[model samples]
Target chain A: MSESETTTRAIQVPILTRVEGEGALHVRLRGNEIEQVQLKIYEPPRFFEALLRGKPMDDVADITSRICGICPIAYQMTSVQALESIQGIAIDPEVARLRRLMYCGEWIESHVLHIHLLHAPDFFDCDSAIELAKRFPNEVKRGLKLKQIGNRLLEILGGRAIHPVNLAIGGYYRLPRHEELAALVADFEWGLQNSVDAAKWLKGLTFPEFEAPYEFVALSCPDRYAIETGEIASSGHTSIAVEDYEKFFYEVHVPHSTALQARKKPHDSTYFVGPLARIQLNYHTLTPIAKQTAEAIGIAPPCRNPHKSILARAVETVFAFEEGLAILKSLTMPSRSRVPYEVRAGEGVSATEAPRGLIFHRYRVDGQGKVEFAKIVPPTSQNQAQIEADLRQLLPQLIACDDAKIALDCERLIRTYDPCISCSTHFLNLHIERV
Target chain B: MSRVIRRVVIGIGSAHGQDAIGWRIVECLGRLGIDDVACEFARTPLEILDRCEGIDSLHLVDACIGPESGRLHQLQWPDERIVALRWTSTHGIDVPGALQLATELGMLPTSVTIWVMECEGNLIEGAWSSAWTQRIETAANRIARTKARAVRGEIFYRCDRTSGL
Candidate 1:
């Protein structure tokens, strides 16, 4: 372990398994001192931005929804918001409530999937969720059942769970019956308790003692924990309008990744997003049950430990269930399902809190409603820099450990973000070079 | 009361590159206008599970990465020859993995078959390659013909005779 001793070792994990998309991790060390760590994203770029040009603006939601299967609603929500903004169409309050309900379903689905099927395996030292299930059968079944409830909610409201066809520029193609929404109440009531139990169960798991100083960003609404729409709020920064997303942040192409990494302007430093950031920035706005659960689990403000994100996701799942049930109980059918609007030449930008983090969509449409330009910034790309930075801080502490243990630790760190690499065209090739 | 047999055909693939082969086959089956068999397209294999309930028989078509590009591999479940069928997917559990899990949970149909076409091209979003187009037509026609026979109460396994595997 001496500085004078020459030690060179390389670890290449050809592919990182159990996460979405294709990615690899590379770490370089010079005689026990960490030289560099790069989370390489090699998923082929699909050129969704270029593909949107010349297509009708109405098709934007459907097209972008195909970007990520796990988080299709996020794409749909962001796209519809941007398109509606361009035409200045004020959606009905009832329609907005329905939208929020649908978003809550997505949060429940995505968060549970990540917590039980993806992230929990790393904690239990299992190869996959299948292995995890072997040890914890009842827990895995409960998680899957919770996920099914979320899917059923999406199916009821969005038409079909994956790439739902009901979403349009203004609102849904049709509204759900009062009875349909009422039936879901009982399920949500059960789900609320399940989510709470899941969080408490995760609280008992062991987490690495790690914390990093990084900027946490998420959408902040005035009333509640932002999911559907809100202003961009970062730790130690004033609220910025969604329309000024481009002005405040920009994506730069990195040599190692096909996806562009985002950085805040002026200072040009990396920031983190997703559940942990949302919980930290908007903890005060959580529902009563969710807030109490977080406090009981010992989650305080400004939580810097990324490993605790699983606990944060569990708390958010509880919030999603409570919020969805409340929306359904007070829901009233809108007079008209969608408002009519004429196409106008203008630019629009919208940011929504996706299950993983903040997702931004911008569009420029012609007078005929044809999309002239489009840009989408998924959360994983924004968190890529922060993922690497966290690894840099973590590697030095684990340098003395065996290569396999170090590799496992690196994978665990990456999984903490619960990155949807497919959405970002993104993490498991691990390479460590020691000299 | 006698329970009516419900049959479903699901084509699984993304809208990118040769992965669209499953979608193309489903689209072609739709044009054939078969009323008895329900046809759908899934972006990933995990979506196939929910669609399998109440189905007497299920057919899944998808693209595969293998040594022989453009060749079709049709696999029928309950076949002793195939051991531990594991499908590896980046998005979620792969088809074989899902099928095993579903069977364990007692959610799988009595009869299930999967048709996979080898695809060597990049899976980016774009038009289908010429080779994939021909394979799509062949797969769709075979699937449609099988559905037509099933509707007539005929028990026929088409791929068993012509399968190169």
Candidate 2:
């Protein structure tokens, strides 16, 4: 294994094709020296920004929701919030609560998909959940039911699973009945335990112990751990309002990819988002149940380890469901589902907590309520650079493992970000290279 | 006698040559919402043929570009004309290649019925030109019933699984 005698090797893991969107990982090696690692995201350009032009503000939520089926609510909420912002309307707290219910469903569904089906198999040495079902049928079934319940909650609220077509600009076309909310509450009784078990299960997995200090940024509220909206903060101790996203974060385009990888402004450094950050930054604001589970797992405040993120994600899933049911319980039938707003030609900024991370939408509306310009910065695009940075740090240990082991592990790590390659490209192939 | 038919209506067209044909019939069938059918909107021949596997029967409605603008041609495969035309997926997979792979894998559909719309829209965009648009309901109903009958083993057939749209 001497450097002089060691051979230079290169392994190119091109974007794994045919799942959701497109992304790839390229890493090079000279003997044991890991030379290069690039998370190549090559999704074809879809002119979402261009497409938004001239579309009525009313249609923004409906149209942009198609951006990614997995996090449609995020797009819908951001679009709606942006439209509302243009008209100088701060929606009712009740409206925001309902939105949280919708968002919780997304978090539960998405986190279950990732923590169990997509990411867990890598840790457990299975091909997919299809395989995991054999040895752990009950566990798999639990995961499936958990996922179905989330989707059911979404369908009950929004009318469809993949893209809930019912979410309008101001609010829903129709609000939920008391019975529906009660039904969701009853179903969540079982959901809570499943989420707790999921967290425990993930906690037992072998995690590579590494703590790379990152500027963990997420929305935090003094009252509650904000999901959809709040003031943003970083572990680096800087805070910004949602309106200052473009000011604090910057997007850069590289020649190798269509995605505009993002970086923190001024410092031009990498930051992390999603579970570990949120749980770490705002552990105190978690609901009693979430806090109990965190305490049970011995996940104290300021949890810094990234590998234990699945546990954090699971905890968030529980939080989303509990919060959703609570919202449903308090919500009686409203006379009108939406409060109409006429456009006044203004610039607006909207950010929502997507299943993955913060989702941003900026729009300049025309006097006629038509969008003149639009910019959608989805979570996946933001996570792209951070994913690369993590890979750079983690590659040495990753390559030390056997190739297959490392590839699957890399896939799991990538899934942790829940990178919606489509949100980035305009896309993704998930490829992993080990050298 | 009980299971529902999965109408897998595929629309294929290449706008430049005989490419406009698939789209014409697709518009007609989309509204129909045939029960027990998994009708998917597609352009590539491979998409149509590959997805059609394991079905007891398939009613493929597509357009044939060039001189046949409005002429509706009914094709029952095991026919040379039906076998000759290539099928390719959007991801660069051809029909014949797919069939070969299917044959090797033993996954060909039990029966496949194809309908070709003779069209001349050059497979380009704006080719809503289905000469059969006028004949759509009748054409669709005719094939729908034909496959329906064949799938259920109507008079002279015996399929363990009665299937079609």
- Candidate that scores best on lDDT: 1
For model 1, residues A1-435, the per-residue Cα lDDT tens digits are 564348567776665666787888888888767877888887788899999999998788889988887788999999999999999999999899999999999999999989987899888888877777777767877887898889888888888777777788888888877788889989999999999998888877888999998799999988988997889999958999998888889999999988899998888889999999999999999999999999988675868999999989999999999999899888897788898998899999999988889999999999899999999999999999999889989988898898888988888888899888784332367888877
Residue B46's lDDT in candidate 2? 35
Q: What is the lDDT of residue A239 in candidate 1?
A: 90
Where does model 2 exceed 4 Å of error?
A: A1-6, A13-20, A176-182, A298-300, A398-406, A423-435, B1-165
Instruction: Give the alpha carbon lDDT tens digit for every residue of B1-165 in model 2.
Output: 877655566655433345544554555565676667665554444334346656755556665443645556766544555456644232222344334434434445656566765545444455444444575565666656665676668722222221120
Per-residue error for A117 in candidate 1, Å, reads 1.0
- Per-candidate TM-scores read 0.85, 0.74
Interface RMSD of each: 3.7, 10.5
Q: Is the docking of candidate 1 incorrect, acceptable, medium or high quality?
A: acceptable
Provide the overall lDDT of each model, using Cα atoms, as 2-decimal numbers: 0.83, 0.69
